[model samples]
Target: MAFTLTFALIAALAGPSVAESRDELEKKKNGVNSEITGAQQSYDESSKAAGDAAAVLQASQAQLADAQANLGSVRGQLVAAQALDAQMQAALAQSEADLAQAEADLAVGEQNVEASTKEVISFSVESLQSGDPGLRAFNDLMNGANPTEFTERKAISDTIADVQLDRLDTLDATRVILDLNEQKVQALRDQVQVERDAAAANLANITVLEQQAAAQEASVAQLVQANSANKAAADAAVAEDAALISALEADRARLEAEIQAEIARTTPPPATGGGGGGGGGGGGNASGKLSYPLDSVRLTSPYGYRIHPISGVRRMHDGQDFGSPCGTPIKAAADGTVISQYYNSGYGNRVILNNGVINGVNIVTTYNHMSRFAVSPGARVSRGQVIGYVGTTGASTGCHLHFMVLVNGSHTNPANWLP
Candidate 1:
């Protein structure tokens, strides 16, 4: 019994009657529409997220710029410090030279003082021992002779000794002056040493500053690299967002087309036995009128001014073509009275229906390329009802339904009339 029931259920599901359920078709159509909407929403959210990322990247770039500027400032300071250090080094070297010169001057002064002392001692010995009368008298006067002799000789000797002594004193004064100059030089040397030490300390500071500058520069470089990477990511995100938008748009268009097709399939055919003429009862209902003349067919040609497929020339095409198997069912486009069902030079096996007077305006619909007609002249039909079958009739090419819409007998693009 279970096996029999399973077989029955499978048979029921496989049947054409089950496959053609309107509710199932509607559900599938809604599902497609829903997918399209969901894709569009996700695309929008991704785009917004990409924009936010871009903003963050911009801020990071700005920060990187500031970091670079600071690095440059540090580098400048480092350079200045290096220059000052060089100058200080030069000054220190000069100071060392000055100190050496001061020591040499002091040595020279000491040597001069020793040489003057030797010369003074030798001159005194020579004055006492000289053989000349004045020198001998001078020497005797120094030894304390008689009063008159002592007075004259002592005066001459005293005068000579005084002169010699003054010379020695002058030499001694010169040595003292040299010693003072040496002291001044030593003082200058001390000052220079102090300056040199300070300069060395400053050079050490410069070294530290250089290190800081290098670190700053490295930071700037890192920031630059990071900023570049961020920008690239942001650009990629933007591109992805754009691509998603395009995909969403395409999906939306596909879903809209499917929805329109579903609506056409499910809606009941318009009544052919209408009170007034023209495609359908006018006003808003006209907008909802079925657009396609047939179902389950591929579009062969679209309505508009198009290049003639055979002639390769710009030509005005007044209708659309739906390629279908021969004898495929064609239906009335809208509720309207059948105005004419006849053949013509260009349109063979054609039918013209007056839709109705809608908003006080008359509209007509035309169908061509019929293999066989189901309705007769003056017969009424409803929308979606098979009125004829597809054929390659009238100025024909392949098997297709040639459909047209006329507003007051003027051919217009059929897409405008169809949903």
Candidate 2:
């Protein structure tokens, strides 16, 4: 399991903050897409090697299947984790830089505030007429370490900046700016701590994964050599993994059903400018067709019946697995409301979008194996907006988008809708 560190903010931000968030999201999305492209090339090369390993293996079909299954996973998981580590490293660096800059800004702001306060105090002592408002205002500003007006900061700022009669107003404005700088510094410091902790955890996981990858890579040749004892070990490991996935999926399916029911119940009549039920029509912009959830789609697996990689059981795949590396930007397939965003041990981090009816078929889409989500559940997203980053989570062998679609409450091929 990868460390899908989702840092959620609790503030009920509005107005310009919303626009600022979107701009930041777009910038981060672009960065992830660029990094993922490079990482994807490396992951593909390892995948190709796995295929070539399978072709050359001279073993029983069962042995080959089981061994290929585990080896591919081991190799792919390592690469995916390494890519995630790289992204964490980049983020950690940026956070450190931000923290430094914020501290520097605060220091400068504090100096300016102190200087302005002293200048106002010294000059106003001589230049003031008796009972002047400027002298009284300066008295209030200096008397308290944090003025009682600090609680009424907005009112204080409006009075001072709008009705500037003297240098005292300039001093007052400097103090308000200083307070804002302090808040900014504290926020940056908190961000730095979080990134540092996540980076450390990621590095620890990668160390263990690297060892597993090396052992699995070596076992590929041993499995091909038809070692009976090693074969049993591989089978056991595969079975254990499959059982875990099965459990997670079972729980996810139950929860997902509840989520769908919740959406349907909350949805109002379409005649009243409300959306449809059963998976479609939460309604942002889905009208006629759907867009691909990923910018670059390399279909490693397709929707249909296929032999399961871990369990070797033939079952419906139910989604299109696009081979993207960790940190790849995942887009909304259509303008829709995010009805659900949650993590399953088997699905990793997933976002279910309730896209409006397309043509006549009510449509919904899901993006899975996410490193982190940009949009929260209930957010109305536009088509092609970045919603999350691709990651290797749950039962993933590597970083990819396991994109699924449902039409009117029935599982359907994503390819049928994606252009």
Candidate 3:
């Protein structure tokens, strides 16, 4: 009896050889995890840089378009100014011609006045030399040959005085017209100068707009180039990370295959009948009497149909989430063989256990978002054994246990199985 008890104690204390093989694999997995972490960090930094570059490119493109539009408007202004300048020049030329013609007409008027003065002086001298007008009139009346002849001589003298007065009036009118022409020419020149100044101002504005457009174009080109470079870097970083992850997964698969072989070679001795009755533990017993997977449970999410937080798609939620502090110890829900432990894209560090049949239905439970594993594949674990720790790994928002139960390969709500 003493020897038999000693053998039983030894068997209970030591783990199977298959478990030893799993330890080596877990160590390699940790190494691969470190590499994945490094790759993910690189990818995140590159993606942020790419996003910043894209923002700069967007702003630069908008500025470039505005500058181009402004340049077009400025060019139109310049064209309009040129047209106005040409019109002003033509007007100035016309004004100059008008002034020149007015001066020439004044010159002709002055010469005519001078000739009229000479004619009046010659007539005065001839008339004075010929006779004194009042004395001759009186003599002719006293010794008149006929009254009709005397009346005709008086009428001729009156016509001569009228013609001399008309010449003086014509000279006065010419001087007035010459003065008006000078004023008109000065006013037209002032108008031309104002138009010229406006044209110059518009041209200067157009030059500034052109320079701005050129500068904006250069900025846009630089930003676009930077954006392209950043995008390429981001793409390459993501691709490299994907390749590394693929290679690591392959390694994990091979290691798992070996673990499965080791389990086959070192299969445990079979039980003859039902092993145990209900026991006090943190997890379920062999009788399918379930226990809480943690010492204290706070439901973060419930199992049901719901919209996904990230993708916003309606899908079935196959698990229950329990909030926990980071690195909190997690227990197995029932007696089970460790089926697999690996990194999952959505589940992070995961461990799935086949907990044997319950009520004629195959019961499988999964623990996800673990920081690391405490057990290994192919190891037999009793209820309440430490299987892993809580973490925010693999598509998780925070530290939590995503606990799931499956029945015969189909997912079922974990809440239904939990007490």
Q: Model 1, residue 393: displacement in angstroms? A: 47
Q: Which one is best on TM-score?
A: 1
Error of 1 at 128 (Å): 8.9
What number of clashing residue pairs does each candidate have, in the order they appear? 15, 1, 0
Provide the TM-score for each candidate, comma-separated: 0.52, 0.40, 0.44
TM-score of candidate 3 against the unseen true structure: 0.44
Give all candidates' CA lDDT scores: 0.64, 0.63, 0.62
lDDT of 2 by residue, 304-360 (tens): 767556534344576789998899899988776565577766567888676656677
Candidate 1 local accuracy as lDDT?
0.64
Model 3 RMSD in angstroms: 11.8
What is the alpha-carbon RMSD of candidate 1 to the true structure? 20.6
Task: Write down the worst ten-residue block by lDDT for model 1.
Answer: 1-10
lDDT tens string, model 1, 97-137? 87778778777887777788777888877866774446677
- What does the lDDT read for residue 75 in candidate 2? 74
Off by over 4 Å in 3: 1-30, 48-153, 199-419
